[model samples]
Target: MPATATRADRSPRAAEPSPRGGRMGALWRVLEGPRALDVAALLIGVCTAVLTVLGLVMVLSSSSVEAIGSTDGSYGLFRRQAMWAVGGLAALLVLRRLPLRVLKGLAWPAFGLAFLLLSLVAFTSLGHSVGGNTNWLRIGGFTMQPSEAAKLAMALWAAAVLERKGRLIRHVHHALVPVLPFGLVLVVLVLLGRDLGTAIILTGILATILFIAGTNRKVFIAFAALAATVATAMVLLAKNRLVRVQAWLFGCEGLETSGDPCFQPDHGIYALASGGWWGVGLGQSRQKWSYIPEAENDFIFTILGEELGLVGSLAVLAAFLGLAVGMYALAARTTSPFIRLTTWGIMAWLVGQAFVNIAMVTGLLPVIGVPLPFISYGGSALTLALAGVGVVLAFARHEREALRREGAPDAPTPDPSVRPQETR
Candidate 1:
């Protein structure tokens, strides 16, 4: 007591601990534990598993009638889908284990291979046409859609290039040069094969990557407008597409029921309407009995809705929403521009395609021939989609390691401007 203490000095030397601070400390401690997993990574993995399993079930149910009619028996299509599922899961496991550097190294090669495959589809005898879109390649007894592989390849290539550009991406010329030209060529290739749906999805992937890389605002808007114009022109130029658009704009009324322009849309609506709030029950969809074409492919959602009702439909949407949240969270947490852009690009591919498929089935949009990501019956689509997820999972694994090394707090903030210290 060198001097008389004031009233403030006489008060307690330590202030009471804040409840919020205590909770935050507890959370950090939990996250810092040795066995801790990244919440985002877990969420994504779980959702993917759920959707894929559900897809297999729905494929079996929806394809039974078609499979029995077209193939050896009811299980033929389901068996093929199951085999592809096995291959896809294997890919997911292998990809999730690879280092991010290895993925970056593979990007260019993937792009080149995709380009070659697409070229074969567009100009060679190997090209196989289905539903008027010659986007598939046939060899011996096997067939695959090159455009599906291109979707993943383009996303990877764009992310790798744009991330390397760094702050230079702010310049329009630097941002658009090779990326824009290469992307356009890929889209043109797909279009040459008459796959407008795949072209649209590919264009979306490019735009998403560019936006994530922080391209100039004016340039981005201009690019978007140009893309819209091209898409509209392409639609108007195709008689089939134009007819579908007309059906979407004007009701299917006054058209002959036998060869109706809105036959698919009308049947899709009927399937959904037949199922009340609870659905008709699994394996009981009358739509799959040939009322809706492509019951196991493009219009699987309608069959799902018909059998499982609105509840099942909502469940599928929730799974996709979960995927979206998880991917967004991973993208936000990573400091690597490649990881951020790739995550966003894949997100656009899967989630965007899912919504487009659902919209088409619901008649909110014209029939685009896009498959629902995990639930569709195409081997190429399922395999590539899983591979894309695998790449993102690899990024997520890297993020989890980074968090562990840094001993992340309750809310770890990453600076996007700073280059990540650990490239591997």
Candidate 2:
């Protein structure tokens, strides 16, 4: 150099001048720091807590009238949900503390059990039908939905299998062989139980796993087409499903009579329309007073919209969005295939199901009986969802430990003195 610059003149602090820009820069630095994953994990946990608590509140409000009429008291459904929540929290704690390998080892056994349960639900006298779907199993005094458990089992099993397949996942044969067959068996069993909604969700989870594993684009396209065709056929064959689809396509206007195919959908829209920007006020929803069917279960989002208004509904959406972002960030940052794939599968299951439920509530999609994740009043669904979150937390914990052991540094600083070279 003709003249060397002074240390003060070459200081990096001289780079920026605007206070707003400086603040933004600092924010970005913090976000990009080594504790980014920690922040993500915290975000995930917070969103889950917020959603679950909100769900409990909404469930209590929505189910009060029905509970008072049918069960012990106004707090009957709420008490049952609280008990399930305790059980689910226990599951979360246990799974979160388990080693990743232990989780992986449980994959096959879990899948086998799910398969066996699904088989029993579909083909045996032990199956219980609710809302015309024989997807539940009653043992003694307890009733549980095998389809819900199958979702978690499917995710875990797919993650374990796809990760083990390694680069061979790119090959069509390896990608479709065991994974597709097993997934189809589960889907078929679910369909046999007449639970099309759960079957669609299961298909989605399987497809998500394959996509995350880097399956060929053409194969994915073909698989999607096949799934669509099969779903269409199922809808066409089932008169009840066909009627629901017709009601959705045309309008549910003037079809509010109870027992009509459009009764639930019509009332759902009415509830949402009643809740303007501020809503009708919590626990004040008239729709939940024996108007909308399954107000505490599949159609709970409508009750939520009616009570909390648009702002509350949007807040719920935001929490789910945060959950998605945190889970996706964790998956992206992790180097292990199992961690990444499993996180993505769980993300798709929970987030995807939430959107499906919301869309159904908003009438953007036909009324499918999929429950909103962490929000719907279903013991089996809530328990399994929390258990899945626990699995994700375990992965996040493992990643943090790996980072700590490696002595990972903060975001790398760019060299101020490095000059750009001209290219010919």
Write down the lDDT of every candidate, Cα atoms only. Answer: 0.85, 0.86
- Give the TM-score (vs. native) of candidate 2: 0.88
Error of 1 at 407 (Å): 3.6
RMSD each, Å: 8.8, 7.8
Residue 280 lDDT (model 2) = 93
- Using lDDT as the measure, the top candidate is 2
Put down candidate 1 lDDT per residue, 204-254, tens digits, no spaces. Answer: 999999988999998788888988898899888987787778778986676
Across residues 286-392, which tens digit of lDDT does each residue of candidate 2 receive? 99988986699989988999988999999999999989978976886677788888888889899999999999878899987899988899999999999999999
Clash pairs (backbone) in predicted model 1? none
Candidate whose TM-score is highest: 2
lDDT minimum window of 10 residues, candidate 1: 6-15
Clashes of each: 0, 0
